[model samples]
Target: MIITLTLNPSVDISTTIDHLVPEQKLRCAAARYDPGGGGINVSRAIHRLGGKSRAVFPVGGATGSLLEQLVAEQQIDFQTVPMAGWTRQSFVVTETSTRQQFRFGLPGPAWSMDERELFLNTVLTFPKPIDYVVISGSFPPGLPADYCAVIARIVRQRGARLILDTSGEPLRMAVQEGAFLLKPNLGELASLVGVDKLELDEVEEAARSVIQRGWCEVVVLSLGPAGALLVAKTGHADQRIERFRVPAPTVKKQSTVGAGDSMVGGMIYALSQGKSYEEMLRFGVACGTAATMNPGTELFHKDDVERLLNWINQSGKKVFLPVADGIN
Candidate 1:
């Protein structure tokens, strides 16, 4: 079974407006709400792809109450720990004229050490033997930077694969702790290696560096519209690393929200289905690209993923999976 952990969950609300003039009261269309958080979104995506994953997160306040209702509406299985602070809320306003979107996110309420312990115990005692443990999203205030790292260790002890899709110090710490897989954007990858910037051509080397250091066994460097680069640690330690780049299929664009999470969800679903790493990236990129065709935080549809994946497979480039010759 696949399990997802979302520490800082939220209720994402979005609406579109015609025009804005100096803070005037702007009339907008009806709003839409969805369960918002990295892991929650991933679970939702997984469900849409005809897969199953249990979403684990904290709950507090009336917002948390509503979040539960939304998750149930999506028919996702979930478990929650009581939190002291209210859950956060995110607002997105789209400018119909320019097609610009402004997202306002509130920092979630802080949690106490006892609360953290309870959540950790909950994970350690998951109902089933976990096949894959996905830890995504940000750590709420007061949670230690090593939050994901702790879960990484636990997942490893259980001999389950851990896929981390997060950023900043928490991501770095989890990498240090060693995860089975990672899905980091270009910017997040640069930060993991202590670089201020990276050229498109340098993405492969940077990703391999992470694998060689034992931080992760595989790295899926998401390049947004350019698609993703998959780096796997295979064969002898002295051999060159295996890598593949899948370009995203072109499509009508709507909102960019939830694309990355959708990709991670897709990849996870593919992995569970025993697909190759190359095909994993292809299907993942398809889901992410499909998500861009919808407004607000809506994820991709299975039909869209299938159509895009077919195009990507037919037009795949002659990219070789080179074995890693170690980090140096």
Candidate 2:
């Protein structure tokens, strides 16, 4: 079984407006709400692709109930850890004319130490023989920065492969404990290595550096529109840094939100099915492109993902790679 943990889940409200006028009343052309947070998005994507996974998150207040209903509608298995405060909510405003989006996010509610303990205990009790565990998204207020690292350690100890996607200090700490995979965009990768930013030439070097430090066995650096780079662990003579560039497909612009999560979902789905790393990367790129073809925070549909996958297979480009120096 696959288990995904979202420490801070949210209710995503996306609205489309015709135009924006300073401090003036505006009418919305469309509005939609969805249960969100990185893990929830991953679970939804997996379900759409006909895979099974469970989503575990903390919930509270009216918003939490609404989120539960949304998940139930999708028929995805979910386990909610009750909290004393309301779950966070994010608002996405899109302009129809300009196709521009502005998002307002709220800091999630605080979690007491007891609540944190409960979360940890629940995770430890997950049925044994778990195949993979994904720890993604931000930490709620009052939750320690080491929260993700602790979860990753437990997951690893239980014999399940771990995939961690996050940013900043939590991500740094989690990587130190070592995970099976880490997916960070180019910018996030730069931050992880204490660099201000990285040019295209510097990406592979940075990715290889992370792997050498024992942070993860595989590091996938996502370069939006330019595709992604897969850095393999050192020492294996056959190991080499592979690069894939999925040219952004032409699409009516909407919102870029959730594209990264969709990519993670696609990659995990392929991995769970025992696909090769190259195939998984292609599927991930396809899923991300599909998500961008849609509006707002909505994820890619099964049919769209399939279409993109077919296109990717037909392209048949040899993803480039960088030469590896023995360092394992």
Residue 29 CA error for candidate 1 (Å)? 0.5
Q: Which candidate leads in TM-score? A: 1
- Residue 52, candidate 2: Cα error in Å is 0.6
How well does candidate 2 match the true structure in TM-score terms?
Answer: 0.94
Q: Model 1 over residues 22-74: C-alpha lDDT tens digits?
A: 76887989999999999999999999999999999999999999999999999
Cα RMSDs, all models: 1.8, 2.0
Clashing pairs in 1: 239-324, 239-325, 240-323, 240-324, 240-325, 241-322, 241-323, 241-324
In terms of lDDT, the best-performing candidate is: 1
Q: How many pairs of residues collide in model 2?
A: 0
Candidate 1 regions exceeding 4 Å error are 235-240, 318-328
